[model samples]
Target: MTGRLSMGSGQPIKLAERRVFSDSFKPLYNEGMSLVERAAEYLDGPGRVEARKLSRMAATLYAAESMRLTTRLMQIASWLLLQRAANSGEMTRDQVASEKSKVRLDTASAPDNAIGWNELPEAFLALVNNSLSLQNLVRLMDEEIYGRNAGMTDMPPPRRSNPVSDQISLLNTAFARG
Candidate 1:
């Protein structure tokens, strides 16, 4: 069934029209995959060299941050793959909805300790920041499309009363005066 909602003007607005998953999903998929590749390359190459040059404590922090970065990217990749399947009709909307529970998008804040943060390679930090930005965007889309609080906005549209029903109620009340 087509996902359509009636507007105040009595016109039906297609949900897909408002946000075509294919249109936005493709770019996100490409960008996400590319970033993942870039991160992997940097971590394995220059990142490894940089980490080895750091002090023991800083090296440990680098390792932890690298793991976190990879985990975050994996989560994003899983979500994107699911969306791609749904968009391509390989999976139904219901299937996608059910599978969504399996994918947890963590929004944990970045490390606050400045002890070894500055010691981290600038490239690694840039990747982390980029991943965070992408994660935020994905979270927003997920909420808009599937969250329990979907369709709710800060300012609601004005309610339209049915004039005919109001008139009928008024007539009924008047005729009952007999």
Candidate 2:
């Protein structure tokens, strides 16, 4: 079955709240299986087998990353709340707010435009909050894809380190070759 690509509206989209199950995780399952199958078709004998093995490896990595991203999202949510508290001069302000304002994860718009947990400052409190966000995201994704505990096996996309890092690296490589 084919599925539609969804965009976040402005409100938050909690897949966990929706109670999506393993059956919902069909998209990812198909993707994982397809990667392995395609690798098998393109690779011959040992190479084909290796391709399949790599596919599985990629799937595993994706799952782990998905879990991590979920945790980070939760952390970000908590951090946002905490900031609100601190802004109001709470008794204990454990986390420091960013010098600049941060955009919250509002499903009311788009995931691509959403500020990710990783976008938070790389500091102690930020890291803690980021982790929480990741955990939450994974929980939600799992529930959304496969109801209950099924989402636990979700394979997510690779975690690209620092958004600017990739750009900088590409530029450096280009200049070095010149």
Candidate 3:
């Protein structure tokens, strides 16, 4: 299903038949998957030992944060897999669009001033931070590609300033200085 998206100019831009999931997306996908795997390993190994040694409040926070981290990673994985499916033509853009609704892109934030935050295991904190970062990246991409949250209306197109001409102007100025 094709739809027109306005780019703040009241002009309707036709959605392209083929979406370009650029080479950059591959790195993001890889990073997200790697983070997920690393988080799993840590949670199963070092994280478990660390959690057991935590104070009562800290242990509770640890459980909450770890669960949030896992949920965030799952969402990221879902987004990446959906994009890969669309890229490979295993799934159509329309199919991906519909399936996108099922993935929860919104992250659950931990309380900013939680009592045990300072006492949480450093390794767990690192994993949580990394997962949150990945989640944000995936969420941005989802909004951009899927037009989530009226993102099409909110996002402005990148401004172009004729890079070749700009380069030539720079060169002219440099040569004139000599």
Against the reference, the lDDT scores of all candidates come to 0.68, 0.36, 0.68
Query: Sort by TM-score, best first: what order?
Result: 3, 1, 2
Off by over 4 Å in 2: 1-54, 89-178
Q: Which segments of model 3 are wrong by more than 4 Å?
A: 1-20, 150-178
Q: Which residue pairs clash in candidate 1?
A: none
**Higher TM-score: candidate 2 or 3?**
3
Task: Summarize candidate 3's per-residue lDDT along 1-90 as a digit string, tens digits.
Answer: 334577899976644322336455677778889999999999999999988998876676677667778987897898789888888789
Q: Write the per-residue lDDT of candidate 1 for residues 35-78, one digit (tens) a residue.
A: 99999999999999988888765565576567668987887888
Residue 22 lDDT in candidate 1: 59
TM-score of 2: 0.23
Model 3 lDDT, full chain set: 0.68
Root-mean-square deviation per candidate: 20.5, 17.5, 18.1
Error of 3 at 137 (Å): 1.4
Q: Each prediction's TM-score against the native?
A: 0.71, 0.23, 0.72
Q: How far is candidate 3 from the true structure (C-alpha RMSD, Å)?
A: 18.1
- Error (Å) of candidate 3 at residue 46 is 0.2
